[model samples]
Target chain A: MINSRDILETIRMIQDENLDIRTITMGISLLDCCCDDIDRSCQKIYDKITTKAARLVAVGNEIEKEYGVPIINKRIAVTPIAMLLASSGGDPVKYALTLERAAREVGVNFIGGYSALVQKGFAPGDEQLIRSIPEALAKTQHVCSSVNIGSTKTGINMDAVAMMGDIVKEAAELTKDDNCIGAAKLVVFCNAPEDNPFMAGAFHGPGEPECVINVGVSGPGVVRSALKKIPDGNLTDVADVIKKTAFKITRLGQLIASEASRRLDVPFGIVDLSLAPTPAVGDSVAHILEEIGLETCGAHGTTAALALLNDAVKKGGTMASSHVGGLSGAFIPVSEDAGMIDAAREGILKIEKLEAMTAVCSVGLDMIVVPGSTTSEVISAIIADEAAIGMVNSKTTAVRLIPAIGKDVGDELNFGGLLGAGPVMSINTASPAKMIARGGRIPAPLQSLKN
Target chain B: MRAVITVIGRDVVGILAEVSGKCSELNVNIAEVTQSVLQDMFCMIMLVDMDKCSIPLADFSDIMKKLGEKHGLSIHVMHGDVFDSMYHV
Candidate 1:
């Protein structure tokens, strides 16, 4: 039996608290689309993605209307273009253009997987794809790119890390006029998940099915609201409240994923148990931390609060859905979350503190904007540090930094919408040029030896 | 298929009659309804069977929403499964 209290609670969560399904990402494998000629491969890739995801947006809308829950983005993730580039052996930008066309045709908000996985070393097409990311992203509006430059098993690829530093700078420089949006669409990951449904880091890995539907659920505001009801509760009470709230949120995600999978006739993939926040008021993971008794998001003890919240979310979400994968925890994207943005502007959320938080949270250095004069080596060093955290901890971490080209530490770069406005956060300018120039791989950690 | 229709607003005269009349017009069968008045606010939750409705649930929801707007009420219609999945296992 359904009660009025439950129905009203659900309605309030949607209407006031901004509860939503962040995305319904269809992962399509482009491995079979590869051909000897670049044009033929592009054609095959376009046809496959367009056909596979043709009904994605429409079905997402139908579900949204029927369920009364907003599905924010309908996206597609394909096999990394680098693998196909190895076969086609031409300009990788062609694949980006094809993906953009397919995304526009099929009406997805973003098409991810313009990517390369060079965690150990650069393969035949890996370097080419990495070098072309700036041009590819600058040329296309709806395509997202990621490069996995390190992992626990293979360690950090310093050469790829160095190259990605230049690539991230070039991407931001190329799109400086558009609020440095190119870099916003590009992510550098360590231990990247294969079936992540979020962007700008989502991709269909080689291990995935030919076609699958993955769902990302979000409800930071709902969790925060639940905590507000327990103002004098102990820390354990806080964890229990978050666990119950996360369970409800993930159940909705599972329901929607199953419905979409059944409708699209594609296999159902995991439900990413994430608390993804937007710039909208009342929708922030940072606010959840504050609700846990922090003066601000970057205050001391913020890491402990985040660690508790992330663990509780995963614990509750694990039981709600049969399959839980991807970066299943709290996402603290500096720009996307309203509370984080305010904290950044107030100088409370420093980059170093964010790096520490990433050790406990889901992603790392996400949507952070640095000064234009900051060198590529600094960005690479930042990636190395974040990658080291993920490599050592054996968790997924990513860096999506925008070099606010022609902008300074205090200036704000507004991309609007879900990408949000990034306040240019200060970076340490001390050079790491020599370290980056060494161009050698950091050996895998002892944690990787369990196999 | 069944849906949950919730109407919330300031206490109004004949709000139930108005809503149930629309359901009858659309051939939707009302399975259950619960209403309460707290102070000056009125809240109602209705479980309606839409398997024999005259219009699609989406369209029916829009119609009910428009009707609520005319009477200054907040309205929402969602699949019952959303509630079952969230509140239940």
Candidate 2:
């Protein structure tokens, strides 16, 4: 028998605490859509995505209304475009335009997979796609792009890393008039997941099934509220609370994923157990860290708190869902998170401290706005450092930095919406150019021999 | 399919009658109902069978929400699976 207390608790979590499904991403494999001619491939890609995700938004709405749970974004991730580019030897921008059009027509928020995987080395179409990312991102509105420059097994590709710095700079410069929005849509990844449901890093890996429905579950607000109730609890008790809260959140995600898959006649994919924060007050991963006995987020003990939170979330969420994948942990996007924005604006959250936090957090240096004068070499060096951590630890890490063109540390760039405003955080002016100039792969670390 | 309809507001006469009357008009069968008053504020939970309802789930929810607005109460109709998946293993 269901009790009133349990029902009321669930209702409060959804109504007051912002518990929500962050996205219902349909991953469609475009491998079979490849053709010799570029236009033909574009047409095939458009048709496949449109047909596979035709009812995605409708199904999401139905589930949302029925369950009284908000489904935030209905998105689609396709097989990385580099594989398609290898067969259709032509301009890759055509693929981006087609994806943008399809996204608009199907009424999805974002269409990802304008991407390339050159983590180990540049394949036939890898370099070409990476080079064209700036143009592709600048021209499209709803399309997201990503590039994998490093992985744990294969190690970091320094050549691609070096190119990405310039690519990010060019993207920001091209869209400078629009708050450098182009760079906001690009992600440079280390050990990028094959089935991430979040953007701007989600791309359906080549190994993914033909069509699948993946759900990303989020509730930083719920976790924070739980923590607030046990203010004097010990560390173990805190972890227990987080675990229980995450379990409930992931159960909802599992329910929605199954419902969406059954309705769309697609295979059910993994549920990403992520505490994704938003610009809304009381909805922040950083706030959760603060609730865990920190004066503020980015304080000295932030990394350790984040490490505990991430592990407990996985422990609880793993049991709730049949399969848990994607970057399943706490996301600390600077701009999109209200607590992070406050911490950054007050100079409490430095870039280096955030970099250390990323070693334990789910993603790395995400949505950080650096000074426009900061060099591309600096950006590349940041990526290399982050990739090294992920490679050595065998965890996923990514970098999504936006250099605010013609702006300095004190100024702010407001992109509005989910890509919330970011206060330009200062960077170390000391050049890492000498190290970044050494453009060669960082060989994979020894996995068997633990030091 | 069954749904849980929750209504919370100031205690008043005919609150239950108005809600049940709307359900009867839509051919919805009420499986169970529980109501209580705390400090003159009313709270009610009604489990209704939606399988034979005359209208779609979305339409029915909107209609009930509008009815709640007319009566100055907060009403939410949601599928029972949400509570089951969340509260139970």
**Evaluated with TM-score, which candidate comes out highest?**
1
Full-model lDDT for every candidate? 0.95, 0.92
lDDT of 1 by residue, B1-89 (tens): 98999999998899999999999999999999999999999999999999999998878888988988999999899999999999998
Residue lDDT tens for model 2, A1-451: 6677777788788888999999999999999989989999999988988898999999999888888789999999999999999989899999999999999989999999999999889888889999999999999999999999998888899999999999999999999999999999999999999999999999999889999999999999999999999999999999999999999999999999999999899999999999999999889999999999998888999899999999999988999999999999999899999999999999999999998989987888899999998899999999999999899989899999999999998999999998999999999888988888899999988961455
Could you tell me which 10 consecutive residues in candidate 2 chain A have the lowest summed lDDT? A442-451
Instruction: Estimate the TM-score for candidate 1.
Output: 0.99
lDDT of 1 at B12: 87
For residues A215-319, write the lDDT of model 1, one tens digit per residue.
Answer: 999999999999999999999999999999999999999999999999999999999999999999999999999999999999999999999999999999999
Model 1 chain A scores worst on lDDT over the 10 consecutive residues at A61-70
Deviation from native of the Cα of residue A62 in model 1, angstroms: 0.5
lDDT (Cα, tens digit) per residue for candidate 2, span B5-26? 8888898789899999999999
**Which candidate has the highest DockQ of all?**
1
